[model samples]
Target: MQDRFLADVLANRHNRAILERWDDLALPDAWLVAGCLFQTVWNLQSGRPPEADIKDYDLFYFDAGDLSEAGERAVQARVDALLGDLGVCIEASNQARVHLWYESYFGHPYAPLHSSRHGIERFLVPSTCVGVRPGEVCAPYGLALLYDGVLGMNPLVPHRDLFERKAASYRARWPWLRMAADAATPHPAA
Candidate 1:
């Protein structure tokens, strides 16, 4: 499963380019994350080009020592300079600082994250929660739901309204993706 998923994500040339040059960025514990990884696989499974409908690349890094907005902007500037020519937006976020602004922006309180992986775990859909860096893939929840095109609310972030909004956006693009009604009932953590 890991090998196949790796191959699927790398099929997007921009993902490949970013991973190849990832060492150039000095951000700590950084991982290329979220929509860019899952959506590329979705696009491929739908027989569309791997890069189709990809809005931006998300890069998550943990910098607890410097949680200021300016610190995040500095990292983003570095990301832009390195990957700007790719002609796609690359958004770099400091996972450590999410708690400071999350409640105001997303209207939900987010506790401080211990690591970038912790932040990844809070994504609205477990199947869509994934991250990658050179030589590594961080998918705590396996790929079955993603491969099956199943959309379920993530237990870690079980907000009905937010999940509905997010799932609707995804289903809008890939009408074939199925939403499991029972998935909202909490189960033991995966």
Candidate 2:
């Protein structure tokens, strides 16, 4: 499943381009996460272009050595300098600093992350959680639910409001995606 998912993700030209330059990113424990990868697969499944409707590419890295907002900005600047010609939004987040602002932004306290994968594991939905770079495609919770199009709340980050919002947004875009029995019930279609 990992191989299949990875191949499907790379089928998107934008994703391919980013992974091709993984080494150039040169950040500690860095991985491209969330929407860009899983949504590519979703698009392919829906017979749409692989890169269609992808909002942004997310890049996460753990840098305990520098937790300041300025340090995170510097990393993002480097990413922009390197991949700006891709003509897409690429968000590079330093996982080490996420905890500092998570509470204010999300109305919940988030513990410090130990690695990029640790941050990836806390997505609102377990199935939607994935991270990739070069030879590595890390889906710590596996890909069964994702491939099955089932949105389930992640035990790792059990925030009902956040989960409902995220699931609703995804379902709004891809109506074929169904809620898992354990997932928060999605909002009625508007």
> For all the candidates, what are their Cα RMSDs to the real structure?
1.7, 5.0
TM-score of each: 0.95, 0.94
Model 2 CA deviation exceeding 4 Å by range: 183-190
Give one digit per residue, the lDDT tens place, for model 2 in 97-168: 898999999997898888888888888888887998888888877887788898988776778899899999
Q: Give residue 166's error in model 1 in angstroms.
A: 0.3
Worst 10 residues of 1 by lDDT: 181-190
Candidate 1 stretches greater than 4 Å from native: 182-190
Q: Any idea what lDDT model 1 has?
A: 0.88
TM-score of 1: 0.95
- Tens digits of per-residue lDDT for model 1, 70-152: 98898898899999999999999999999999889989887789999988888888888789998898887777777888888
